[model samples]
Target chain A: MSKVKIESEKCKGCYLCIEVCPKKCLEVSKEFNKKGYHPVEFVNDKECTGCGFCYQICPEVCIEVYK
Target chain B: MNKILSRPESLTLIQHSYCPGCGHGIIHRIIAECIDELGVREKTIGIAPVGCAVFAYDYFNFDVTEAAHGRPPAVATGIKRVLPDRVVFTYQGDGDLAAIGTNETVHAANRSENITVIFVNNAVYGMTGGQMAPTTIEKQKTATTPFGRDIKRDGYPLKVCELLAATGGAVYLERVAVNNIKNIMKTRKAIKKAFQNQIDNKGFSLVEVLSQCPVNWGMTPKESVKWMDDVFVKHFPLGVYKDI
Candidate 1:
């Protein structure tokens, strides 16, 4: 299974990845960073197909998928 | 491989939306080639601004995000912050960066955000029907400045590199043109440096390319290059403004 990691400090809360994920494995975490923004989180890594759609759509380049 | 030419896998085969002989095509090819050479096509993320090159998303093989007018910097900043491991850059035009999004560009650089900005300055606005742009030279005629751009009224042309370099956040800044083979080579080098700066985690690199918009400039493609060499270069001298 592929895994996705988010560098919490860099998340701008664009949430573009959340909108494009076909697996719906990502969401904005309730936790806020130093920038006072809710970063993205992988809700279900097992559901991730790793199609890289979320990676492609993310403007912040925050998501990395390891297959 | 010739870095100046386009790679089949890196670029879409469709005809570009830019005007005949417009520099955007050349700029696009150079950028795509760089991405291909770096083997970052899959890992690179590009932000396209709203301008003549708005369809830039269609040209590159890598993943792309369409940013609101003048917002590519902010979008790229967000992306770079989140995905520091990935290479992120923005392709913007004068009207998008220097005019409406000037604040965003300035602050992004001021913050030394780890992102690359490819700023295309063609003087007049290309997509919006040739209005006077922030980089349009004084006494130049455009749709909005039919009589000629009066410096006193419209203000002076914005020298982006000079302005951005003054900020401590910027790590690399260069101004190059594509009017000739020599300058085109220089532009490619500058662009490569800008991207490498980001890869090295250098903050806020920008390459202001003096491009041509023949249709908007009301000149033939050939004449536009001549105009750029004769006129535009006079106002925007070509050279590196900063590198660290």
Candidate 2:
């Protein structure tokens, strides 16, 4: 199984990854990051196919995928 | 198992200062990735423009120097001439490149300067409160053109790649967008080639990236992307305009 690690504070709440993701493993968080934006948070990794679609579309470069 | 995707080595840990969903961060990451892959992080010298990416030095871990508005091509030409073995590239926005630095860019391309130019064309002046830029599309609304750009008054957008293709010195010229996954992949390839051309002593390569400015464009991040894919690409078709 692959895993994704994200630096939540670095996210700018763009959601480019969440929109591009096929696995639906990412979702918007109610809590705000240090930047005061509701950055996307990673859900359970069980469904992560590691297609790398989210990582590629991420403008923040905050997501790191380990396969 | 190893890490499949992470931050590029050439990029610093400092978070991007661009607006949320801004395309500058994506372009920066890809440029850093290309530099890392080329193994020229130490030898690479970047000339930053006076646009939203002015703080590019803080984000890129490599040696980067700031240039006056639209003067990166001139500065880069001088640097590349002095350090022939070093890889030099300039990151300029449309306002800086096509408007303020038009003469500088044209002359550099005419001279076939051995440097790469990364031109980000979002069709609006992003840094200075979303004013109209030289590349602003016809009938596009901007701060200066609240009602929308009037072709009779403002004229049409400048076609940079096509204009540069007529120059004898430009060895390569390509235009790509970064609105979606497919376009982003093509953009990465085009950017990497622009850098590779410099490393190979190929002269005057420019990759025009059609990026999005959600805040300035008055659209959500997703809407901005949709605008880029649907409308922006129609005006500036993405493809290699020249290759030698």
Candidate with top TM-score is: 2
Which CAPRI tier for candidate 2?
high
* B115-156 per-residue lDDT for model 1 (tens digits): 999999999899989999999998999999999999888899
Where does model 2 exceed 4 Å of error?
Answer: none
Which prediction has the highest DockQ against the true structure? 2
Task: Please compute and give the TM-score of the first chain of candidate 1 against the native first chain.
Answer: 0.92
The candidate 2 chain B region of ten consecutive residues with least summed lDDT is: B194-203
Q: What is candidate 2's lDDT per residue for B1-244, written digit by digit as tens?
A: 7899999999999888899999998899899999999899999999999989999999999999999999999999899989999999999999999999999999999999999999999999998999999888888889999999898998889999999999999999999988899998999999999988888887899999999999999999999999987888999988999988
Worst 10 residues of 1 chain B by lDDT: B1-10
Report, for all candidates in order, the number of backbone clashes.
Answer: 6, 0
Q: What is the lDDT of residue B132 in candidate 2?
A: 93
